[model samples]
Structures are given as structure tokens and as C-alpha cells.
Target chain A: MTINKTWLAGFVGIAALGLAAPALGQDKPDNLTIISHRVHQTVSTGEQGGDITKDWQDANGVGVEWVTLDTGALHERLFRELQLPETNIDIAFLLNTRAVDSVTKLLEPFDEHMAANPVENIDDIFPGLRAAMTFDGTLYGIPFRHASSCFHYNQRILDERGVAPPKTIEEMIEAARQLTFTRDDGTKVYGFLINGEGYANTVDLARAWDGDFITLDYHVATTDEGMMKAVTLLHDFYEEGILPSNWAAIKDEEVNNWMQTGRAAMSLNSCGRNRIFNDPEKSQEAGNIKTVAIPVSEAFKDKFDVAPAKVEFWTMVIPANAKHKDLAWDLVKTMVSPENTLKAALNGNGPVRASTYDSAEMKNQLPYADEEKAVLLVGRVPLPPFDNAAKASDIFVEELQAAVLGMKSPEDAMASVQKRVTPLLPQ
Target chain B: MGRRFIYLLMAAPVQVLLLAVIGMPAIYVLWLSLHKTAFGQVPEFVGLANYGFVLSDPYFWRAFVNTFVVVNIVVYVELGLAVLMATLFASGMPFRRLLISIVIAPYAVSEVIAVVIWKYMLEPDVGPVSAILASLGLPELAWTTDRWAAMTMVALLSIWLHLPFSFLILYSARIGLPKDLYESAATDGASAFDRFRYITVPLLMPAILVALMFRYVFAFRLFAEVWLLTGGGPARQTEVLATYLYRHAFRYQEFGVASAIGWLMVLATLLIASGYLRAMYKRMLTGDA
Candidate 1:
């Protein structure tokens, strides 16, 4: 039903007033605002945020205020506000997926920013990281944090069992079998546990078998024999009762708990988990945990001729409607500056820059720095550079999980996934 | 005329709020459903394409079937238990007040907390429930791994969550029954079971129908509990429409397809609700006439 013009005008007037009230009180330029999703401790702690904000104020001669939120919440907020012509966000810290998906439309390209700040030493950043931040030959993000999947095992358990950490897929399975036991109470203990419910889990398992869900050409690639092998290998873990029956519900934190309690002998976890082991308050198995590259199948070993390391990176980007785009770039430059990047690396939770890794500070901080470096060299990141990595991963993982649970055979699960995902892949 | 104008003036605010909050979004979603859009791209007009795509999708059909199965299981179980408990309470059992309070306690806990509590209880190694089963010499079951078992576990949780509301409504309806009917039934040599079947059951049907409708809707939209508990895993065997739509819209960012699926869900819910309302209306009219 159409309303009278007078009533509509009155309603519009009230909304206008409501919208105008917030804008009336702002002295816009004196303050630099940065909207970031790194609300958790390694990024925005009392020490970290305070130090960064103080340094930013010194560098830019402005009163800088930082607003922090979790990743998902920040995306919702930024997506809404940035749709408007003038967003208040000067800078944003988002993950690689969001940056790639939303950057061209929702964010301004960072090439101009980098070009203007040539003295920022952007070249010194790792090439893999730089490539990760670029989409369609234009820079969209600056790398901030890097992660890789590594096998975190209990040294005490392995030593007691007279077994060494597995370096190949077959050895890993044998070790997993050896570690499993059933108690008199009929409670079955596991040797290895990984998330079997989602795409990330499948991708982790697929890496060992050299399977790719989507190939570099961006086609559905899960119907291959290698993918089947990967699915079967994971299924065998469950079929043999070497992995927890509740692996589908298992989360990263739960995996950490299993390792810390010495309940599981091994888990494929992010390298950042090392910090948890080093923290006396959090870890029961501190000083007894060792990290190594994930085991590879014989075929993958021959193909890459090295142990496969699964590399993951986190990036920060500015939204298109950011009020202070220049200021945001300044913040990005400062945060990723060699000195600060090195500080973050030494603190055990930042991106791996070439300079940061070779620095004496990092060496002093990480006890296993040499071993970590060796593993990092051979790390393999997921390919195809699709914006739907998270969703694709979820589907892949769920399908693999079906195989693991014996609901579907490896071939059947992969075939089903191919049918579903093929249509969604970018041409 | 002046009085009518005043009434219009008074109602305009609510009408405008409803239009802005509900009507506009519904229209927007409908518009979106008829388009084609991929991640990081502008939408293009594609009349009926998304609907066609959704209709042909196996995942959509699977999720639709799963939703119905879950709804049916949860509703029937919850209704039976709720009616029984209400009758026992209506019979003036001892500690009626305490029993009523205890029966309604599960409603106080949020769905997430309920799922989390159950998850721990059903854990393979440390869960007390699994331990109990093992002690009883029963084969240890992976509650979230086996497809049928996972669906059953989710249905069980759904019923558990809806039980308190169903019981409260049925109990109130039972309490409201005419005292003379029960007296007449007892005097007529009606057995306890006969009294329940003849008097209590008939009287509670209205409340039961309402309770059933509410439970059906709640069980149909089940997402958080399922997501946190199983994440629709073991190969999407436990996936319902809501979780499937979520994966499409947010995770896949296929907004057009997601919107189409959403409209399909709305249509399905409407059809189910209409059937329910019609059945209840017919029952009510026939019983009264």
C-alpha cells in the first residue's frame, strides 16, 4: 500500500536526523582510526596494541585509536560500512580469503600505496608472501602472519615406545597403530587425531597423498586416484581404530589438549601451536614436544623429492571506503616494518619474513629455530587462489570425513564431491 | 472520518516498522533469488535460473529430506512424552510443583550449552555416557561418526530441548480442564487409563496441537546444535537446510543460489505450517460443532 506523501516525508526526516547525529560531533582529521580483526592476544594485547599505537602516533603525528574485533565480526562490520561511500576505517586487518574476494570492489588496490612508499623495503618481504597478497597482478594485502601444518608429537611417548617420528605416509600409519591401545575398562585410546569434519581436515590429509581439490587451472580435481588414496589413508586410521571415533567433532584446541595430555602420540597442527607448548602455564608437555614436517606418500616424496610442508599465511588489507586509506597504508608499513616484523617473529606469532627468520632475535626466541627453518623451506600452500577456499575446503573435508567414518568408500565420496564442487568452480 | 484518521495515524508507525524490517528484506531476497552472482562479482539478471539450479541440486534434496526426518522424529517423540508427563502432573502426583519445575529446567539452558554438555557426555574416551555403555558390555558407539547414530543423537537433543516447552503447555492445558468432567468420569466407573484417554487427552489436544506446531518449527530450523555437535559431517549426512544454506551464502558466497535455497525453505515452511493450521482448524471446528 502506498503511503501519503506527508507521512513518508516525516518518516524520512526522522531517519535523516538519526543518521546525522553521529556525524555532527566528529573532528575527523585529528584522529587516525584503524579497524582490525586481530582482537586476540598476539596482535592487540595491552602491550602489543599499546606499543603499535604509540609508535604509529610518533610516526604520523596524529592521535591514533585502534578498534579491534574478531575476524568474522570484522568482516560483517566492514562489508556493511564499506558499502557506503565514506567508511570510517582507515585500515583493516583481514584474512587472505576476504582480501582476495572483496579487494577489487570493497578495497583500494595497494600497488599505488607500495609504489609511493618505495623506501619501505617491500622487496625484502618473502616472495611467497608477496605473491599471496597479490591478486591479478595487483597488490591487495600485506602479509602479517604465516602458518604451516607440522607434525607435533610427544617425544616422551615416542621414546618410551621405542619409535621415531614418521617421515613417510606408511611409517606414520605404522606408528599410529603402535601408539593405539585399549584399556581394561574398554576405553580405546588413539594414536593420531585430525579434524575429519571439514575441508581443512581433508586438505591436510590430501597434502600427504599429493591430492588437490582444485587444480592450479581452477578445475575440480578431487576425482583423481591420488585423492582416493588420501581418503583411504585417512579412513584406515579410523577403520584400524588408531584415530578417535569422535574425530569429526575434534577441533584444533581439542587436538592440542590431546597432545598436551599425552593421550595422542601425534597431530598435524599449525606451527603457532609451538607457543602453547612453550608457555609453562598452558602446556603440561612443555619441553617434551617436537615439531616436524608432515609425512608424505612415496609418490609425493618422489615428485617433490622432499617432505611436504603445508604453508598457510594471514594478510592485512585496507577497505575501499576506508576514511584514512593513506593512514592505513602507513600503519601497514609500520606493522610490517622489518624491526616490528622481527619483534613479532621473536614473540613466536608473526609472519615469516626472510629478514625476520635470519635475525639473531628470532634465533634467541625459538629453541628449535634451526629445525623450524628447515621445515619451512619445503612448505606447500594450497593452490588455485580461489576466493571460495574456505567453502571448498569445508566440502572436501566433509566428503573425506564420510569416507573416514565408513559411510562412503573413498571412490564414492570423491565422486560425490566432484559432482557437487565441479559446478561451483570458477571457469 | 476523523476517528478513522486518528486510528490510521496511530497504526502508521507499526506498519512502517514492519515494512522496513520485514517486508523490504523479503522483497530484496526475492529479487536476489532471480539473479546470478558469484563471489566478488556483480549480479546479473537470470530469471528462474537459480530456482532451476536449486531444484536440480542433490545436496538441496538431501538436506530437504534430512530436515523432514529430523522434524518428524523430534515432534512425535516430544509430543508423546509431553502428554504423558502432563497427565501424570494433572493426576496430582506428590510433589507436583517440584516435578513441574524439574521438568521445565532443560528449557533454561541455551541450545549451544546443551549441545556442548552432550558432546562431552558422548565423547569416546572420557565421556561418562560412553563409559557407562562400555561397562554394560555394549559395543562402544561413535555417536557423531555413524550416519544413523548421528542423526538419532541430533534428534534426541532436539527432543530433549523441546520437551520442557511441550510439557509446560500440556500441563497448563490439563490443569484448565473442567473439574466436573473428571468427577463424572470417576463416578461412571472409568478406569484411570480411560479417564486419561477420554477426558485428559481430548481436553489437551488444542494445547498439544499448538505445542506440536511450535516443536515442528523449532526442530525444522535446527542449526547451531547440529553445527556445533557434528557440523553436518560424516559426509553431510546430518546436514539440514539451514546449515546447507549457510554454507552456500557465507562460505561459498553464492548469494543467488543461497537466496534461492532460502526462498525454497520459506515456501516449504509455509506449506508445512498451512497443513498444520488446516488440520488443527478442522479438528477444532469438528470437535466444537
Candidate 2:
């Protein structure tokens, strides 16, 4: 009887052990899938796509699968996956425009994760960035890149016109006129370059003129007096031929080409694009490209302490249904650790932390570092997230283009925008 | 069991498969269209609201018109080019296989790659083709800003890429056509035009209609050409139904409206395709054309 009982106990122990083996394996998933744009994927990749995830993968004994998607598709996929109980996506990266209530509810809040596995110095991150990602005092995402709008221009063209970079919007207008010329090589240089149909940049330009399109609290100001003035100014710019004929259709890639080939004098683009314009192999006018703070509007020069600039940033979030949240947090820590943040900036990511710009190496190595830092302090995302935000943007772009293209008067266009967009705002 | 009952019993598995693959999705989309849906939000019943919005939206009509115009141009132009090439191929042309290979090359290339190639070639500022046009003192194509130019480019690219599909169908039919009919017409001193008009046209009508049915349906869903090339920009002037649906579905997250637009596309396609099906489908099934 004693021998039989001992044999039963041994059998029960073995059976229990067999059941728990798979559970133990489940604790450490073999792979964590992260999706972002190719450019933003460089964060896991070291400077210029060096392998930064090697140490993390080695430490965790799990592979990192990086999937790159365009900005539009990223938002779509993130939302779709989060709704599923079984999701392949462990981590996701999002732009500022995607931080609306619909998406935030689907994100795993970072309070518990931060308490257990802290980022190097959470306080060192920009207050605005933290605030933007926080909903009702719960953090949902960590800042990955903050690209501030900066003034970029052809130095050779400005020099040829015998004028320095314009400091005020009024001066820039005059400067653009003088700068427009035909080179000996028959290249027709426009004084200014812009994607006139783009709502983000158009709104940024309008905002600088004190034209408020929509306030963060869902206030509709498209028909405000300031916006009328902005429309008039832009229409006048288009009429004077300061902007290219294809300005209404030129997207970001064309803007790069226009500037790099020495075909345009000035543009306001995210500072990250500075690298593309200044790279010798990619640009014919590489060395001659210069960066500065966006010129202040004449109206707001005395009204504000700092110049107005537009800042749009991207962030990293773990989905609510993520299989390995703890592991994802660990990987996030490795990327945003104090030591790697500076390295990421050097590798061409827009640095999110204020301390990154303050570092001695950052100030020395990056040419536009000071300008970017200044812009970050003043700039905010051109449009904030709302339920109907994308629709609002489309409506604004339509009206803005109408005014610029002479289809409607600036007054009527702004009125039409206000009428159409106000309905999209939350009551 | 009766004959009809036995036929249904034998067809049950395939009917079930068709239901699983096609009918269920159509029903689900129909349900979705009846409600207002967005990400992470409970779907609320708003019967006919999405369709109402789509009908009232000016851009929807613009996209519909653009789809009609562009698809017709692509189908007609592609068919014209295919007929020309098929005739040339039948005439014992030199280096026929090389020319055939060259003609079919674009069909094999993926849509994204083809768009990228054309975008570079037609780029006004620095494209090789644009440069050639400039040297010859021709007016530059402002496709980026001009609505008509953008539409022209979209039609041109669609024809270039899908010409092969139409050409193969017509080419096969032309070869299969009775040689004795043409020989008899020639022996009777019929002109080449007369022979072609009477013998070739009457015989190839079935193939032509077949090509039209497939091309019209496929071309109506012309998303990539307009999406990649023009993005329906310069004030939504060049938008087609597919891109319009995409904007609502993906960009704005308005699934309800997107589903409604999708159903409208289906209805439009059916209305257009019903004509050709009624005329030629019986002949096609009987191999009598």
C-alpha cells in the first residue's frame, strides 16, 4: 500500500509539470511586431539605419519584426488590430493627428508600465509632448519624434539678390519677389515654394498670420477676421507668381526636388527634411542650403515673445491587446533610454527630449539643432485630433484652394470653410 | 427526389462556398451601410443617412463622372490599340515575337511599379519624356495642377498597362476566325475594308463585347492610377469612385459611407454590364459566336 501511494504521487507530479511547460513558454513570446514608417523605423535602427535592436534582441532572446507602412496606413492598421482580441501587433507608432479619443481608448495606458519599468528620465521629455499623449492624466504614448517647422532657403539665391534671410513675413514677401529670376542655365526660380493644396502647411501659414482654423477645444474659427486676412495674403502671393504654377499640386517629394535643384528660393519644412536638402549626393545645391527659425508675421512680431512655428510629432504606443506588454515596455525602455535618445538624434530622428538638444554633442554635430530647439518651444501641431478631424482638414483645404485659385473671394471662401467645418466639430 | 431537388442537392456545396465567400460579405456590407460606423465606437443605426450624405456630396458626383469618362476612354482606346496591333500581328509583321513581348511587358509589371515608372517619365520638371517635349518646343503638361491634364495622364497610363489583356483576347479570336471567309471575300473581289467590316467585325463582335465586359468592370475600379498619380487633387477634380471610397473608408474612418459607396459602385457596374451579358452570354456559353 505504501509503495502504491508513492507511485501515484509521482505520476500526479509529472502530469502537472507537463501542463505548465507551455504556459512558461507563453511568458516569453518569440517575436514582437512593431509597425511604423520606414523613416521612423530608423529609431530601432541606429543612426542612418544602424542596428539598435541587436542588444535588446540578444538580452530578451526574442526577435524584433519591424514592419514599415506609410503614415495613412499606419493609423488604419493600428485601429484595426487593437479591435481584435488576438493581434499580431505588439507595438505601434502614431503621428500627432491620430491621437484622438477613438484611438486612445484602444491603447494600453503607460502608468503601470512606467512604475515597474521606468524610462531613464520621464521628466526630461517635453511637457507639451507628455501633455499631448496624456488623457485624463493617463499616459498612452511616449514621444518618439518632434519635427518643428523651420525656414529653409537657397543661400546662393538670397546672396544673388543681395539680401539676407527675411525676418518678418512682409520682408519675406518682398524678398521673394526680388529673388525670383531666370538663371543662365534657364532654370526658372520661383521666389517661394509651397504645396498650396496641403492643409497642414496652409494652416501653419494661416496660423502665423493669426488665422485660427480650429482651436484645440474644437472651436471653429475658419471664418474669423484673421483667417480672412490670411486668405487675402495667400491669394495675393499666388497672383504675384511668388508661388510655382504647380504649387496647388506639389506634394512633399516635389517640394524637395524644387529646393534641391536650386529651382526655388525658400520653403518652410520640418527640420528633419534638412538632411535631405543638404546631403551632397541627393542635392545639387547641398552646401548652399541654410536653416533658420520660420519668419514671424508682421502682425504678431510684437504680440508674442517668440516666433510662431508649427510642430508635429510622432509617438510610440503598445496596443491594448498586445500579447507581451511587459516585453514591449522593455524594448521601449531600451530605445528611449537617456543614452540612446542622443544616439537616435545623431542617427537623424527628430529628438523628443529637451535635454537632447542641450547636450554638448547634439549642439555641435547638428547644424539646425538650435533652430529646432527654438521652434519646439513655440510650435504646436497645426491641427489637433477630433472625431471628424480628417474631414475638417479636407474641407479647409478645399476652401483654401478655392480662395487661392481665384474661384472665390477670400471672404466667401473663409465663410464657406466655417460653414462646412463647424458642423464636423463635436457639440 | 425530383430533378430540381437533386440539382440543388448536388449544387449545395458550391452554393455554400459562394455564400461564404461572396454573399456573406455583401450582406455584412449592406448591414454596415445602414449604420454609422467608426473606429472603436459602437455602430449606431442611421438607415439611409450614409447614402444621403454620399448623394448630396458634390465630390461624389465628380468622382462618378470622372469614373464614367475615364473608364470609357481607357476601354475604347485600349480596344482601338489592341485591334490595330492584332491586325498588324496577323499581317506577318517582322520580329513579331519581340514586339509581342514588348507589348505584354506592362501587364506583368505590378501596378505600383508601373505607376512609379510613369510618374518619373511624365514628371514635368525633370522627366526624360518631358525634356524631349520641351526640346521640340511643345507645351508642357501641367498634370500636377490641371484637372484635364491629370485625367489625360490617368487614361494614358491605364491604357498602356491593360492593353495587353484586351489584345490577347481579341488576338486569339482574330486568329481563330475562319480564314476561308476572308479568302472567299477576296476571291469575290471584295475590298480589304469590305472584308474586314463584314467578316472580321461580325465575327469579332462577340470577343469585342467580351473584352468590353471585363475591361469596363475592371477599369471602373481604377484606384491606383488616380491614387498614385494625381491623388484626385487640385480640389478633388480627378477623383474616381474607388479613391473616393478609400478616402471615406481608410482616411476618414467612415466605414458606413464607404460601404454605401461600394454598393453604389456594384449597382453601377451591374447596370452597365447587364446589356452586354444579355446580348452575348448565351452565344458565349454555346460557343456559337
Candidate 3:
């Protein structure tokens, strides 16, 4: 009877041990899955596909499963996965503005994560980007590709016209008009190129003029008198032929072509696009491209105090359903380490860190690095978690385009957009 | 009883697949359309508020009209061109194989690739079409900005990509057509045109209906061309039902409204397709054209 009891005890112990083994195995994932739009360009193509990830794994003794998608599709996937109780996405890079909409729901607040896994140069990220990544006083993201807008121009054309870069909106208009010219062969050249069709397009100009398009409280500020003035100014530009004839339909890639081919003397484009202008293989007027801060409308600025430049950025966030938060955080830390972040800025899109602009390699690569950094100092992103921001943006852009297309007067368009957006704002 | 049981077992996998793939999603979409559900928020039963919003919205009406007009233009134009080409090919044109291969090339390329090519070709300054127009003293065509011009461009592209499919079906039907009817019509003092109008039209009705139905469904779901070329822009002039649905679902995160729009689209297609099916059934029952 004593021997039988001892055998029973041993059997129970073995059964308990068997049940715990699989649970222990699942405690750590072999590799983490990260999804982002630029993952392919930054990770796979950064150093011939697997070399970069392999090197990082070798150094840190970990592995990753990186997935790349287009920006629209990536967001769709993020939204779907976030709704699931168990998700495959361990980490993702989201637009900094989008993080506001997902904070504390789809994403885990990173204040604790950052504290537990301290990364060097975490404090060196640009203040605008850091603030943009924070929601309700909780940090939910780490800045990745934070870029600000700037006025880019063909320096050779400006020099030939004997006009310096414009410092005010009036000067910009005057310069653009003067720059429009016809050659001896009767080939007409455009003075300005504007991407008039995106969600962020005319809103920037309105914000510059009125100090706000939509207030932080989600009120309709686009119908303000000052904002209408900005709209009229753009309409005047269109009427005077200062902008391209197809300006009402132009998108971002067209602006790149116009600037690179030296057809447009000036353009308002993202500062990160400076890399394209600097690439000789891709640009026809590589050495002649230069950038400056977006000019302010002083008449409007005199009435309200706000930043002159508009900005937008992207950030990395860990999902709430992530299986390996520590490993994901460690990967983020390693990827954004001082040395790797610099490498990322050089290879991929914009840099997130202030030190990146100040680096020797960045200076060598980007001729207008200082101007880009200066723009960041005064740049402002539209505060997000604005109730239904995407919908509001679409409504505003549609009306703005109607004004641009001469279908409606500027005042009418602004009023129409305001009326439509009023009900959408948070009560 | 044993045979019946074996038959049910044999069909079980397919029924399960149909349930998982189609039945569940359709039911889910119906459920979603009746509720006001935002991402991260619990669904609230709204009882057709979404459908009401879709029906009342001016943008939805605009998109519906645009989809109807664009789909009709694409399908009819594609059908006419395919019939003409197929008739010619069947009547013994030189290098018929090569001509057919060339007509089918656009279908081989992916939609995105085809759109990219067309986008470059339509560019105002650098595209060859623009240069030719410039040389001819014509204004640069605002293919994307002008409402009618953008719609025409999209229709033209749709016809090009789908022409091959229509052509192949009609051509095969033409080849399978009985030759004795033509010979008898000729013997009775019928011209080529008469023979074609009487016999070929009646016999090819079946194929034509098939081609039209297929093309109508494909053209109704037009997204890639408009998205890549104009992005439903320049004041939403070229917005179609599919792109509109896409914006509400993906961009705006309003899946409930999108589902409502989607069901409306399905209903519209069903109503149109019902006419064709009824006609087809009549033709089958009467054994007439």
C-alpha cells in the first residue's frame, strides 16, 4: 500500500510538469512580426534584403518577421487586426496623427514600456514629433519618420529672375507671377506647382492664415474670415496663371516631376522630398534645387499667433495584443539606436531625431539639411483625435477643390465645408 | 439510405466551404448594415439608419449615377467592339492568330500596371499624347480635372482591359455557329449583311448576353483605374460606388455605412441581372432569338 501511494504521487507530479511545459514554451515568440509601409525599402532593401536584419539579429540575438504594405492597405490591416482579440502584428508604424485615434485602445501606452526599456537618444527626438505621438498625456508611440513641409524651388531659375527666396506670402505671390515666362520658342514655363488634391492640401494654408483650420476642441474654424482670405489668395493665384493650369488636379508625384524637370520655379512640398532632388540619377536639375521655410501670410499672422510651417510625421507603436512586448520594445530600441537611426534616414524616408540632421553623414547627403531642421522648429501638425479627422479632412478638401476648379466662390466653398463639418465635430 | 448518406458525405466539404466563404460574410454584412458600429466601439442597433443615410446622401446619388453611366458606356462599347472584331476574325482575316494575341495583351498585364502606363501616357507635359496635341495646336487635355474627360478616359481604359475577354467568348461562339444557315440564306438571295442581321444576331444572342453580363459586373466594380488616375478627385467628379464605399470603410472607418452602400450595389446589380436572366429564360423556353 505504501509503494502504490508513492507511485500515485509521482504520476501526479509528472502530469503537472507536462501541462506547464507548453505554457513556458509559449511565453516567448521566436520572432516578432512588424508591419509598415516603408519596411521593405528600409529593412529588406536597406542592405540587400536579409543582410540588415541578419546583422541586427546577430548583434542582438533575435529575429523578426517584417511585412510591408502600401500606406492605405497598411492602415486597413492595422484597423482589422486591432479589432481582433489575438493578432499577429507585434509592432507597427502608424502615422503620428493616426496614433491619436488608436491610443489606449488598439495600442498600448508606451510610458511604462519606455521606462522599462530605456533607449539612448530617446530624448533627442524632435519636440513636435514627440508631442504629436502623445495622447491625453500618455506616450503611445515613438517618432520614426517625422517630416515638415517647406517651399522648394529651382535656385538657378530664381537667380536668373534676380529674386531671392520669398519670406512672406505676398512676396511669394509676386515672385511666382514674375517667374512665369515664355521662352523665345514660345514654350510656356510654370511659376508654381501645388498638390491641390490631398486631404492635407489647402488646410495648411488656412491654418497659416487663421492660426487654425479645426480647433483642438474639434470646432469648425475653417470658415473664419482669415481662412477665407487664404482661400481667396489661392484663387487669385489660379486666376493670374501663377500656378499650373492643372493645379486643381495635381498630386504629390506630379510636383516631384515638375520640380525635378525644372518646369516649375517654385513648389510647396515636403522637406523629405529633398532627397529626390539631390539624387542625380533621378533628377534633371539636381544641383539647382533648394528649400526654405514656408512663407507666412503676415496680414493674417498679425491677428493671430501660430507657427508658420505645417508638419506631419510617422511613428512606431506596439499593439495591445502583442505577444512579446519586451522583445518588440527591444527591437524598437535597437532600430532607433543612434547609429541605426542615422542609417535609416540615409536609406529610407525622413529622420526623426534632431541629432540625425546634425550628423556629418546627413549633411553630406542633404544640402538643405539646416533649412529643413529650421522648418521643424516652427512647424505644427493639426492636433489629432479630432472627432472623425479623416472624414472632416475629406469634406474640407472636396470643397477646397471645388473652389480651385471655379465651381464655387472661395467664401461659398468655405461656408459649405464649415456647415457640413459642424455636425461632425465633437459636441 | 446508404447511397444518400454517402452523397451527403461527399458534398459536405463544398457546403462547409460555401458557408465559411460566402454565407457567413454575407450574413455579417447584413448585420453590420443595420447597426452603427465604429471601430473600438460596441455596435449599437440603428435599424437601417445606415441605409437611410446612404439613400439620402447627395454623394451617394452622384456615385450611383456615375456608376450606372460608366458601366453602361464600358459594357456596350466593349460588346460592340468585341462583336466586330470576332466577326472579322471568324471570316478569315490574315494573321488572325496574331491579331487576336495583340488584342488580348492588355488583359495579360495587371490592372495597376495598365493604369500606370495609361497615367504616364496621359500626363500633360511629358507624355507623347500631350506632345502630339501640342504639335497640332490643340490645348493640353485635362484628362483628370475635367469631369467628362476623366470619365471618358476611365471608360476607355476599362474597355481596353476587358475587350479581350468579350472578344474571346464571342469569337468562340462565332466559330461554333452552324455554317449551313449562312449557306441557305445565300442560296435564297440574301446579302452578307442580311445573313448577318438575321442568323448571326439571333444565334449569337446567347453569347452576347453572357459577355454583357460579365462586362457589366466587372465595370460596376471599377476602383483601380479611378483610384490610380484621379483618386475620385477634382471635387469628387469621378467618384463611383466602389470608391465611395471604399472611402467610408477604409479611410473613414465607417464600416456600417459602407456595408449599406455595398448592399444597395448588390441589389442594383440583381435588378439589372434579373432582366437579362428573364430574357435568357424566354429564349430558352421558346427556342427563339
Per-model TM-score of chain A alone? 0.84, 0.91, 0.88
Steric collisions counted per model: 4, 2, 0
User: Interface RMSD value for candidate 1, one decimal?
Assistant: 2.6
Q: Tens digit of lDDT per residue, candidate 2, span B1-289?
A: 6999999999999999999999999999999999998888789999999999999998999999999999999999999889878877976789999999999999999888888898878766667888899999997787766778889989999999999999999998898988898889999999978987888877888999999999999999999998877778766778899999999998798999999999999999999999989878667777766
| Model 2, runs deviating above 4 Å | A1-41, A45-70, A85-91, A110-123, A225-230, A303-306, A321-337, B1-20, B108-110, B113-142, B285-289
iRMSD values, candidates in order: 2.6, 2.4, 2.5
Query: Which candidate ranks first by DockQ, i.e. highest?
Result: 3
Q: What CAPRI-style quality would you assign to candidate 2?
A: acceptable
What docking grade does candidate 1 earn? Answer: acceptable
Q: Write the per-residue lDDT of candidate 1 for residues A1-427, one digit (tens) a residue.
A: 3568878998999999899866643423677666665542355334532354467776566776677787777776767676777877776666655654454467778888877874267777666667766667888878777677767777887887788878787788788888788656754557787755545545655767767677656777687765677678778887888877788778777877777767787877776677786466887788788876677787677765334555667766777867667766776788788777765664456545666667776777666565555556655466546666666677777777777878788888888888877766665
Model 3 share of native interface contacts: 0.54
Ranking by DockQ: 3, 2, 1
What interface-residue Cα RMSD does candidate 3 give after superposition? 2.5
Query: Per-residue lDDT for B1-289 in model 1, tens only?
Result: 9999999999999999999999999999999999877644578999999999989988889888988988898899999999998888887899988888888888998999999888888887788988899899987666666767888888888888779988888888888999899899899999999998888887777788888888777777889877888888766777889999998887777889899998998888888888778768978877751
- C-alpha lDDT values of all predictions: 0.74, 0.83, 0.78
Candidate 3 — which residues are off by over 4 angstroms? Answer: A1-33, A39-65, A86-90, A113-123, A184-186, A206-210, A298-307, A323-349, B1-20, B125-142
